[model samples]
Target: MKKIIRGWVLVFIFYMSMGTVYGTNTEALMTEKAFINELLKVSKTGAVLLTGSDEILTREKAATLIVNYLGYEAIAKKQNNLFKDVTSSQGEISLVSQLGLMNGLGSGLFQPNGKVTVSQGSLIINRIKNKLETPITWKHAFYAIQSSSQKEWIKGYDAISFGWSQLERDANNNFIISTSNTENDFKVPVGFEGPIDLAKANGVETYLMVYFENKGMLAKSFLEDELQRASVINQLVSLSQGMTKDGVTRAFDGVTIDFEQFLSSDLKELYNIFIKELKSALQKEGKKLNVAVQPTLYFKGYDYKGIGEAADHIILMAHDYGAITLTEVERQAGITTTPLTPIKEVYDALYEAGLSISDKSKIALQFSFASLQWQSQNNQVINSRAYTPSYDKIEARLSLSGSMKHFDHYLQSTYATYEENGIQNIIWYEDINSIHSKIDLAKLMGITSVSYWRLGIIPEAFNPLR
Candidate 1:
């Protein structure tokens, strides 16, 4: 009877141990399932992972499903030890394919028998966040998840906590934030959506994305709205930059006169009258009545002193050292003969005019990348005319000038250089090489800032200032 009791007791103990092991395994599976459910919920709008009827999955199967649904090629490559070799050429493509994100590929690769590491999960989640395009609602939710992911280097319970933190950060970053109540009174819409779309339209999507990431969700929205408002304000301000409107009178481009010729007595009177009107118009627009006057003209013979004294900011037209004309010879000399008459001449003239510009910050330096060319024939100057030369022709001319010693040094020097004349030809105007020089000059001059002759006329590189 005692032997029988011992056998029964041993059996009971064995069963209890087995039951404990099973319960632990069950709990682990439940935790993993819950984590995956969160991912699925977040991805509801576009792509989502499938769950089974029991809604419970094995560890291996759960990892496989994540790898499959996300199209995580990296995991596969890592599993096969193929990443080191394949990553160079086909890595990005493979990774995107594995994420189930390759458009039109129809959801490839969902494995069921693989375990997922915390690092792998974080990488996958981050990629999903990046793939989401603009007008991204719930952006804050993604941010919260990212924060959790970042702190996931710790193992076990700490990893779980980090993941939860990430989710929280994402939620706060996205849905909970509110936009400002201030109305953007501009004619066009102003908000995160508008600015994001505009950036995309302008082929500056990358810049916008960077700006968005750096500023966080709320800040990005505010900045985008402010930029849009500022753009509208800038347009209105620009209209008043060189405009005169009083009663029925309207003038633009510094032109003010009746049908009479320029600078006539009627023109001067009209200019004075228009200036007063411009001031009034600007005041109404809530902009300073800033006028861009020729620095030389303002100081030359004191004719423009009164107007310069009355102006808010004197925008010195320090560029246009060379002007385009139809005369052939003037087009080939390279450097402008009227150099001293404009930039250097005008800058000095402004100083001589005795106009006390208190704020040097208001002065803007205008510079150009285009150079003049003076063409000569038989030792005599040719008329102003433009000649469009192909690369081959330019190359040939350069070679000839280099070989020939007796040719005019100026012509030789000019021939050695090339320009795209951005104002006329929309080709290569200030390349990266020339832009460095311009930036250096601007820095050296201690000028308030530099302004382009025309915004649209310059290369995209010039948009940095804007």
Candidate 2:
């Protein structure tokens, strides 16, 4: 009996040092030994064994987890320029940088102590998952990328998004050329910002969504006559043809219809025909077709089944819930602040659209990085037009230093409020933590893929996991 007890004690020590013990019967023993072990303990899932008081993850902690927990010692062995003020997390930060999973904030500063946001955290985890290259064997991955406003980026409303906008500034800080959202006809200028990069799309299939800026007028013209609709279809075919210009090809594997205009059921049929025709056209050229759909609750008149059958990938754009408070109709409903995209509501709507879990393998949950801003007086919000700043620009302008950051447990969003004058300002937007929460919800719903609405708003490293 004495010899057996001594052997168990030795096993506990080995387990503490090993950190990750996946052997049979050992898991139960590890749990019992955890009560005695003080240096380190194993995770309930047996996926990780973290040190005491290191429950919170940092860059260094992440590195250790990757090495010890995930057995990524080869990546963990590599190191970059270590900071003078940093005594820990160097290996993790270096491993992250070496794999292109994370980048420094300029000047070789890793800021290891800084907390990682949902976007950054999601990016890292996704990259790790990709690096592992584990076979899903069940769910298929669907990706969605959107081509949105050029002005939002050129005007600096979004810091990161401007990088993807393709609008460059001269040495004097002036736009090399001009772009406008007022054009009725769609045209990509010389080397104009297209959609997100498809080359680094990794393994999962992706769709490049082109924004029909003048969709309202196009819908109006199509409604007037069938010939006009045909003409519109011709123009769309021409836009897809534009992708092959200047001897460059394979920019996008598929073309996504990002029309958000108000379409009647009749127009929806016409649009369906348009999509079918577009899919046929792309098929002729050995390409694919995809689409960005509106949330079922907000946008009516869409034949979800018809569109779903026609498109190779369907992206459910379920953002803008928080915009209700700023809308003309919802302000009358006496609503205040809310999440930009509530989790359960989005999932319920998508699932009810008749797409089963298996069918959703090619379906994406589209997310937005913009925030809703409004002023409040006497605890009542002031009515305003659409006003949202990109996550980066807002972070640069107002930080959590003077403001209070609150997480909505029910909605899974991050909001910040600060006072510039006597008026109170409330802004709710997506962040790293909130993004992870949403992704968690998607994973729980058996979703295989998710998407960002636009490029450059979120870090390029923060690619969604398939």
Candidate 3:
């Protein structure tokens, strides 16, 4: 009788050590059922491990399911041992940990046979599905500040490009220029002087943005004429030297060439020559040149290699791929909605830019802090407009309409839809998640700088740098 009792005690201890706990609540059971169903659909190993919805899953088995679903079972099995306590499932544990899919407990203990909690399961699932990473570290930030607002949002940044300096042509097409204000001196807008002082006070660099408007005609003509181009370059160099006021030295650190015209390959050489000459002039006065170019996928007028070598920073306007218009092929295929900056498009742009600009440090991936509203009917877009909405505005709109935002896995964008007055309204907007994902992608590609289209549109709360 003594020997039999001792044997029963040992058996009880062994069973308790297995950590076999059951999920008691209805929600837990349903979640477990759904998880098991998903696993069973993907992997055959679910047949042996997933017994019932109420049964708790061991951490080791959870790791195995993730590995199998990710098609990493064979590779997992080939890995060497990671944890000493995890003898049978060492390969799976090692693989998941290395891929950042899972982590071990303290003291080198993975608790392979321990019960997996609901939080752990949910986090692991999100890691595999969303491909999340820790917060990224960026070296520099370039912001586009609108001078009209006069609201200061340039607290912490490496540099800022601001102004509404528009390029125009007189009757003789003599390459005239103007600002957004009535009283403009040296092409400098009225309200921007204060911001330049603020930027200097905060130890942030400033760049006067030279806007090219009315398509590429004015800019192209200016570039074609050697004498006209020289005059404009000299004017820009003089503008870089800011005037002093009340014992204050206000000067721009550089000038940003925001030429967004539809120039073809024929103008590529002319573009390069203009940029080289401007860069040389700026360098003479201890200033820099920042060239904002359209993505390689859209325009071929930008000589990436030439500009990359001459300019201090090459800002890639990676947004607005399908913001305002869609191609004919897309219309025929019954596609209407488009994200402003898709993840794949950004990646492709970065890849193409990398091909020419070997120095990734000079590259700054620029995105919009705005949103696009698309009006569609019968799977055809009727009209679309882009606007910058504050965070409070977005939340208020969603709350009033009782609409929920949905995230796209492929595009890495957040969007919402609603029907009002018998018309469909689709909004593709930028939130913290969408913005951070792109920033992480840039970090992964070894690019450390990022720029926003303009400020005062996005509220101070949603500032990406913070």
Candidate 2 or 3, higher TM-score?
3
> Candidate 2 deviates by what RMSD?
16.2
TM-score of each: 0.31, 0.55, 0.65
The candidate with the higher TM-score, 1 or 2, is: 2
Name model 2 segments beyond 4 Å from true: 1-186, 192-210, 213-235, 238-252, 324-335, 354-358, 397-400, 459-466
| Candidate number achieving the greatest lDDT relative to the actual structure | 3
Per-residue error for 320 in candidate 1, Å, reads: 2.3
lDDT of each: 0.33, 0.51, 0.67
lDDT of 1 at 207: 10
Ranking by TM-score: 3, 2, 1
Point out the higher-scoring one by TM-score: 1 or 3: 3
Q: Clashing pairs in model 3?
A: none
What lDDT does model 2 reach?
A: 0.51
Candidate 1: misplaced stretches above 4 Å? 1-270, 295-305, 308-311, 323-343, 349-358, 368-371, 386-446, 460-466
Deviation in Å, model 1, residue 424 alpha carbon = 22
Among all candidates shown, the one with the greatest TM-score: 3
Tell me the deviation in Å of residue 250 in model 2.
7.7
